[model samples]
Structure formats: structure tokens, C-alpha cells
Target: MKQDIILKRIEEKLKVLKKARPFPPYLVKKLREQFSLEMNYNSNAIEGNTLTLRETMLVLQQGITIKGKSLKDHLEAKNQAKAIEYLYDIVDSKKDIPISEMLIRNMHSLVVQNIDGVEAGSYRAHDVRITGSKHTPCGAFEVPQKMHELISWHKKNKDNLDIITLATEFKHRFVHIHPFGDGNGRVSRLVLNILLMKQGYPIVVILKNEREKYYRALQKADNGNMEDLVFFIAQAVERSLDLYIRAIESSTKENSLVSLSKIAPQTKYSAEYLGLLVRTGKVAGVKDGRNWKTSLDAIEQYEMNLIRKKK
Candidate 1:
């Protein structure tokens, strides 16, 4: 029932976003660049990559290497950028592109190319356990069949499930399968974005700062409870949509999206309260670098919602 309401909100915001399309080319490029960097840095960081966000920007944008970071770290950043670019090409060029094992392998290959050349894209040959997690992935010999099953399951459910539900469930299933020797989480996120982008959703970044929450949701998902995971992902998808709406709608007298500190003074919510609200998805906003940003309009909507609930 809760998922139904959230999904409705997502679809509604998505409708508003779509009508604003064809968005300006410059806006598309700028937003793409922001999401690409955030996705690359945050996804890699969650998997224990050591590059800081700013360092990642240097590696990705300036072709400059960080002095203390490992060569593998630099490559992971570079490779992820390339992989996401490949993803965008396929997503934009093809309509309803079929998801296949080949596509998954290609994405993994692009992700871990220089870091693990031999098994860059291949399923592991031996069973493995996730470090610091209670779940044990399928046995080594089972990976091939498991992945095939995953693809088949996707085929069966693609049209039946909501896209966000499909994407989050796929994230859990793919990581739980642990098909590749490495880079499963990264690949899962890429696959998630492909599923979303095809459906006209903006690129979703699972923030590295939210790593604990993300893993907790996944843990809940492992036990067959999908609500936490879906809600987490729904928040992320909504954040991306907020960015699109803010960009497209910024030109008018409409409320402008600014950092929480900037907009808090204009509303009843304190900076601290607004931060908590955005972080928890009680209100719609965005994470801009290290700072949280929102608008008076978002708070107004939240207030209206609160009043309606009280009545």
C-alpha cells in the first residue's frame, strides 16, 4: 500500500519531467555530467574504491591522477566513466533494448577492464562469500545457471512489474547472485540505470554516503522483504527527477532550488530539520556535492501534505 503511494508520486513527477522535454541540449549535457561523476564516485566508493569525489572528478574530467591513489583506483574511475558512456549510447540509440547476458558481461568488462583483465567480465569459477555480510551467494558452478535464471526472470516480469520495482529487485538479485568475481555492485547499478533510462527516468545515483542504509535495505531484501529496498531506490529516483525539474523549471518566478542553508531561512523548517527531511525523503530535494539543497516550494508542499494529514 505504501509502495503504491510512492510509485504514484514518482509517476506524477515523471509526467511533469517528461512534459518539460525535449529539454535543452546544454541542460542534458550538464545534468549527465553531474550524474556521471556522482554515480562513478559514489558507486566505486561504496565498493571500497579509495578515490575521493574530487579526486574522481580530476581523474575523469582532467585526466589527472591523484598522487596517493592506487593505479587500480584511477582505472576504476576511468573505466566506470567509459562504461556509463557506453550505457548512455545504447540506451539512447535503441528503443526497448533487450537485456541479455552479453550486455551484462560487456558492462562488467568495461567496469573492471584494467583492474582484473582475465575475469573482467566472466562469472567466477569458484564460490565466494560477501565479506561482512550474512548472505552467501550461490556456488561457483551455479553462477552460470543462476545468471541465466535471472535473465529469464527479468524477461517474465519486465512488463508485469513497475520499472522502479523491477530495477530494485534486479539490483538485489544480481548482487545476491554475485555473478562476477568483482564489480557486481557497480554492474548492478549500471544495469539499474539502463532499466530506468529506457523508461525515461533520469540517472539514479546510490550515494556513497548512504552506503549503510543501502546495505541494510539489501539485507532486508535478502530475507524477502522488499519494501525497504524499493523505498530507498524510489527516493534515489525521485532525487534525480527533482534535479531535472529544478533545472527545467528554474527560469521563471517559480521557487528556485538552492542549498538547504540558503532556502531554510525562507521557510518554517530549520536547516537541520530540512536536512533530515531531505535525507529521509520526507520532502523532495537533492544532494549537491557534500551539501543538501532544497527549495521553498518543496517545503510548502510538505507543509500542505502535513496539514492534509492532520485534517
Candidate 2:
């Protein structure tokens, strides 16, 4: 009975999400395809629950594996992966790990394991700055010593503030510190996801395709306008939900048009529930087919939509 009530509540929440946008069927189809491609790529190995360190390394290297690197050099690219996995394990333990002095050194130590001149787990005594891109002005920035206060503020406000907001803010600060000589971007994202996953949210992979938007959002955060960061994260989260939902929905469709009947000891079918599924793009009927299939992203989106109420 309790489970049934919870499921009903989920259904209601999805109904609200579905009604938020009356997306055209063609738009839904396009979004589903995008979701399918990304989710499939992400789930290839590292993004899945049963992630391997090596696999995670390969995935991260995919970001830096540029036009000039040899296959051997690329395959040996394991430092970032090792660092991220080690940090993931540490953070996943749910310990109240110190973030200020410890996190930078710890992350830097891990980042430089295979790189040259980067002392394992040490911060630069001297100042460091990034070269200007077309979007950024060329200027040397002294790494702010203010991170001590920032981390302290985070620890104190971690509970009171929204986890997504806090996580995004933390990432912004890490990048601003430019703590490490290199690998700062990857480390910061890994740290953000670690916080997010610990908070029970899914790991959001900001795809290469969305780099412009991602960078712009980061810029907004850097400039002290956090709303852009929040909006960006929300959109990414929603996109992830869309992908997972479509994948699950696709699986259900493959099994049968009516998968609920496959749920063991099923109760009477709810027409309202079926309608909700259709509205949310969880179920789709082919022109010549009698049955509908549930896309994985659709189902996952529905689940996440329900989870928002808990917040």
C-alpha cells in the first residue's frame, strides 16, 4: 500500500512536469534522439553504476584527446581518471572531508601523478593565470587566497543552501582559485559531480556539444550571477532525465507495448496512468504497431520529476 501511494505520487508529479511544456511530437522525437545518443555514449562504461577506473579515465581523456596525440600516448592517459576515481571513492564514503586546504592539494596531487613538474598534491607558491581566449581578456590573475573563507562558508552553509546551488558555487570557486597548474577544469567538475551524486542527484555530463553554453554559465557564476549556473544545471539535469527516460521507455517498448502487466501481481490498469505516460513521452505508438514502447530517458525523467517534490 505504501509503495502504491508513492508510485501514485510519482505519477502526479510527472503530470505536472509534462504539463509545463506542450512540446510538439516532432520536438519530442528530436530530443529523444539527442538523449539516446548522449546517454548511450555516457553509459558506455564509466557513466554506468558499475564504473571501472580505467573506463572513467578513457572517458575523461576523451575531452583532451586532441588531434596530435598518438594512440599509445592517448591510451596511457590515466592520470585524470585515477585522480577522479580516487576522489570519488573518498567523497562517496559520506565523510565530512575538509574542502579548503586539503581539497586543492589532494586534487593537485592526484592530477599530477603522470604529469611533469607538478609536485604531487601541492599548490603553487607563485601566482598562475590562464591565457585569454576569444571570449576572455588576457590578464594574469593572482590565485585568490580567499578560498579559505569560501570553503568555510560552504561547510557552514552546505545544509541550509540548495545542494545544486552549493555544488555549482563550489565548482566556480575552484576554477577561480585556479589552484592547480593544470587539470583544474576536470578536477573541479569531478568535485561538483561528487557533491551532486552524494546528494542523490545523477552525474551530469556537460557534453562537448554544449561547451559554449557551459562556459557562458561558468562565466556568469564567476561574475557573481549564480542564477545562470543554477539555470544551466537545471537544464542539464532535465536533459539527463530526458535521456534516461527515453532509454528506459525504449527498453519497455522492446519488451512489450504494455509492460505494466509484466510487473508482478499487477493491480487493475489505470487509464489515467496510461494517459500520463503518453503525455510524458514514456509511451509511444508506431503507426503500424499495436503496442507502445517506453524510452529509458522517459522513465528516468519521470522518476526524477517525482523526486523534485522531496526537495
Candidate 3:
């Protein structure tokens, strides 16, 4: 099939997906902020310098530094959030442009940041491989040709799929190709959220507890069965929606549930500065915990503390 035709088919399928999943106002607000936070977190994690889930949370809440003991530990612990944050930035841009070279570079840059022996912000010209689950394939799988084909194929047929499913398939294919020497899982998940956030969905964080089930779903997809993959992605979307809904509901009672876009203007600082603060462990309130459960008051206090320290 022609690449354009295949892409169009995928896009049409995405339209159906949109119809299948719709978001209300509160959910939209919650998703906007949460996904942004998550993308930043994931991007940092992938580069071999990350905090634990708890430490990341504290970074968001109290702005306390919870450094990793070493490079491997940091990457293993924080890569997921770092990669997702990378995705959020791409998909959440206000430029109204299609995903382009700039975005890919940005994602790659984040994926390789602070990692040892990895060229941060560059694609691997070297060979890559995907190690399957124990129950799945045992042999080490090479991915150079596969990744090149996928990218070329995506460009050829991008129009066929809406930005959302394009992101989803990209995520799937990224992991399938395992293009990087390490951190493929983190990058792939981040790429997925980039697409989802672009489509106006919240960032979906699969908890450590559910990691096995998540792997199993992907394993099924690897075996030429997409039912589980489709189901799992759909469920992730649904959970993202549910997370935002809960956040809105919980915040509404306290009259603190303001939309992120709206808050962006009223604050004394730019989002970029806040993001840096977030990275350095000096601010709080983000979209995580399958919902925006992080406390806004805590965020406020953390920011205030930063202000005092800066003086």
C-alpha cells in the first residue's frame, strides 16, 4: 500500500478513537498541567539522573533535592517521567505546526541528557536492539533498518493518522525498534504521551505496581496480536481522563481548581522558570498519581521558599 494511503487509514482510525474518547472542561484543565509536568519529569529520568517516584513527588511538592546514588539508578528510576515530559513539550507546542525535525531533536536531546556514553540529543547511527520479555522472544533483536523504515513510513503517511494515533503508533514502533542502546522504554512512553497530549488527553503514568501487566500487554502486541495493545492504550487514555476528572472534582471543593493556561499568565514567573525549579527540586503541584493529586498549597509554599532563597 502507498504510504499516504496507509497513513490516511490510520488517521481515519484515529478519528474514530477521538469519537470514542472525549474530554470535558475540568478534565482538560487537569490534563494540561499534569502532562506538562510528567513530560519534564520523564525527560530528566531517561538521561541517567532521576529521583524515585517518591523523590520526584517531593521535588514537585517541597523542592527538596533527592539525588540519585549513581547514574544507572537515576536513569532506571527517572527515565519514564523524563521521556514523557519530552513528549509533552513536542505535542503541546502552540506553534500549530506538524511534528517536525525540531520536535524530534528536542525529544532526543531529553532522552540522552546527563547519561554516560550516550550522545545526548543525537540519533544512534550505531546498531540497536530490543530484548523481549522472558516469556516472549529470547534472541536479541536488531533495530537499525526497522527504525529507519518506520520514520520514513510515518512521514509518508502521517496525514492518514491524526496526531494522536500517530503518536501512539510511533510509541509502539519506537519500543518495537528499540532504537537506542538503552532507555527505549522511557523514550517510547514519553513519545506516546506527546501524541496524546497533542490530542488534548492527559499524561498517563503507569504505576510500578502495574508495570508487569503493562509489559504483558505490549508482549501480546509483539506476538502479532494488537487487541491487548489497543485495549491497553485505550485504558491508559481512559485512566488519564479519569485522573483529570478526579483532580478537578477534588480541587473544585477547595475553589483552587484553576486551568493551567489561565494560571500561566497570573503567576509571577514563566513556565520555563517554574520547570527549571521543578527539575531542581524546588516547587510542587503537578499532574501525577493517575490524577492531579499533588497539593497546590504545597507548590505555593515551595515557590515562596525559592523566592526567599533567591533574595
* Highest TM-score against the true fold, candidate: 1
98 in model 2: Cα distance from truth in Å? 5.6
Order of candidates by TM-score, top first?
Answer: 1, 3, 2
CA lDDT, every prediction? 0.86, 0.53, 0.55
Q: Looking at candidate 1, what is the lDDT of residue 202?
A: 93
Better of 1 and 2 by lDDT: 1
- Residue 162 in candidate 2, Cα distance off native in Å: 1.2
* Candidate 1 C-alpha lDDT tens digits along 249-309: 7622224668888788888778999888877766666555677667676678778989999
**Candidate 2 overall Cα lDDT vs. reference?**
0.53
Per-model TM-score, in order, reads: 0.80, 0.54, 0.58
lDDT by residue (tens digit), candidate 3, 167-262: 666776667666555666666666676556666666765444455677787777677665556555665666556555565454444356443444
> lDDT per residue, candidate 2, 1-311, as tens digits?
22334334434434443443334243456553443334323322221123233443444535555444444333323454455456557655867665666766676566557656555666555555554322332123444455566678788989987666777788877777776665566667667766765654445666655666767877776677878776676566555555545543553344444443342124233545744565455444222143333333444555676689777
Q: Measured by C-alpha RMSD in angstroms, how accurate is candidate 3?
A: 10.2
TM-score of structure candidate 3:
0.58
lDDT of 3: 0.55
Task: Give the true-structure RMSD of model 2.
Answer: 13.6
Which residue pairs in model 1 clash with each other? none
